[model samples]
Target: MTEIAPIAKPDRNRPEPLWHQAEQALRGLIADGTWTDGMQIPNEERLSTMLGVSRITIRHALRNIEDSGLLRREHGRGTFVRSSTVIAGVRGLTSFTQEMAGLGLIVGSRILERDEQAASAEVASALEIRQGEPVVRLRRLRMGNDAPIGVQTAYMPLARVPGFLALEPSASLYQTLSAHFGIAPREAREVYRVGTVAAEDAALLGIETGSPAFVVERITSDAIGPFEFVHSIMRGDRYEIRSRLHI
Candidate 1:
């Protein structure tokens, strides 16, 4: 494979911070496909030498990009470009598989764990179920283009769903619930907050621990009433959160 050249240093006389200059240069490289997704980038020494900045400055620029979800730094390994992941707003109800497919991304998931459990007080409130009611907890590591992008942990009242896990795990959970479980989602509400990736999440998503991420909370209703809730953490770089507003 041909080694990608380091970005040229910016003019030092300019007033911009050295790290910001490096950020611009590196972003250009990634956008132009000089450095593709999952491709390892040059180390701090090389970046410092090529960008004519201190190692600390290079680190700062990389950190900024990583926080922005354009790059990921692996501990004891080098930084790499992040794969693009789509974010579909909950303007209305939608299926996860359909949402990703609509965006033309091949979506898959690693079913980290799945089982039935009693609803906690919070889960009970979200699902509108009695506390200790049986709820199916489906934990999955969501992926796009075969790259880990996010972690989705969903809870659905078992009484409202039947034979959910019997269907393919790769299929849309919402669809399965609607088709066989007769749990068609009619409405949904979502909330988001900036969060840090814990060690478990970081390992599952193939990013550094303490990386910036988005914590998403969602509750969806069937034609009759609400029965599902999801707690999801998404990689900031690979995935974006987008919405539309009407005037």
Candidate 2:
């Protein structure tokens, strides 16, 4: 096992022990993506030195966190953070705006473009419309803390939502549909893949071109019919999807 690095002190006179403080500090770093998955942490001696604590204290802290499934120790290498991918399963009816807001992140959108376009073959097939049917294309970049978090492109049949583009883009599209058309998105079929952020997406997301990104394709519908197709690319570091499963 790699040695733990020195832990940082919490405050001048906090009641917590050096070890517990060290544990929390390390946990924050790992959870916030400051310490990436599979990356070895600094040795225990370094942790002790940095945290103003003894090696024993550092060891105890590391042991606790490791048992929590946040850290994994290799035979010869040091401890590393567990992977940080979020896995929002396709098994529920959840709104992205509500979900992200509940995480205490400010959800905002900047409309990149909105236009009426003839349905492409793929769009037509997904929307179950004729090839030359009109569709509303809305491209947007989502931000949290003024940092780009995800890029989303949504498509809807013009006939289904007559004046959707006229509505403020920053507002929740789903909510607007619900209020105006009584069309609640009851469920969605989502597909996931690993992809590179392209040049345009890189600029919009303020990341280097070709950086790793999570690509999600979603088709949402109500009991009446399918309503929207959304393609989103989320930043790998800033967001994680979570899910629960039962036997």
Candidate 3:
């Protein structure tokens, strides 16, 4: 175990709260490599003594860091440092490839399962198509720098995209859709919620079962109509969804 030095005392004259100042100091340690990834951080008691603050303040600072995906807390074990989360913008209908590329990450995908199937009630509802309609189902493991980040399963009405099954496996389904059927996504709506990773998805993502994850349901439409429905399980520790609001 590496010894982490104590944080500097926050300026009492500043307007910043003690917890906020502690959080910034901790983050600086992470940024400067004082705390490396997967290294267990000092406990609240030790941190409080080092920073000359209360344990409550230390807890608040750790909570903020854990929420930001830079640290993960285990039930019995102490918090551990982790890589910074990958920020995904929620402004447009960008493909996974485009999103990863924007962050300077190498995007990759492994096709887990691909087959033509009848649309279920949920898929039909999302795609605005009749039940039992032919649909192409694709299950893929989305990767960043060859590390698994998410598991995505997409459904597309086969009636509209003929020969889609024959196309080569691709990291960007949007590009495949455009190249094969001249179908470009014009808009997309997504619903996000926090959830635990299931056994199957956890295995694929190389995380423990019941780990925190983000469940995203997306419905995308081209100029013609809704064409794709996607269900994604994104690793909460490795990804963060960001959105900007305009007044």
Alpha-carbon deviation at 216 in model 3, angstroms: 0.2
> Which one wins on lDDT?
3
- Per-residue lDDT of candidate 3, residues 206-230 (tens digit): 9999999999999999898999999
Please give the CA lDDT of all the candidate structures: 0.81, 0.76, 0.85
Worst 10 residues of 3 by lDDT: 83-92
* Residue-level lDDT tens digits of model 1 in 71-184: 777898878877456655543467667766665456888889989999999999998889999999999988876778789999998888766667677557876776777677
In model 3, what lDDT does residue 247 have?
100
- For model 2, state the Cα shift of residue 10 in Å: 15
Write down the lDDT that model 2 would get.
Answer: 0.76
Instruction: Show pairs that collide, candidate 3.
Output: none
Residue 28 alpha-carbon offset, candidate 2, angstroms? 12
Candidate 3 local lDDT, residue 153 = 95
| Candidate 3 global CA lDDT score | 0.85
Candidate 2 residue spans exceeding 4 A from truth: 1-87, 241-247
Number of backbone collisions per candidate: 1, 15, 0
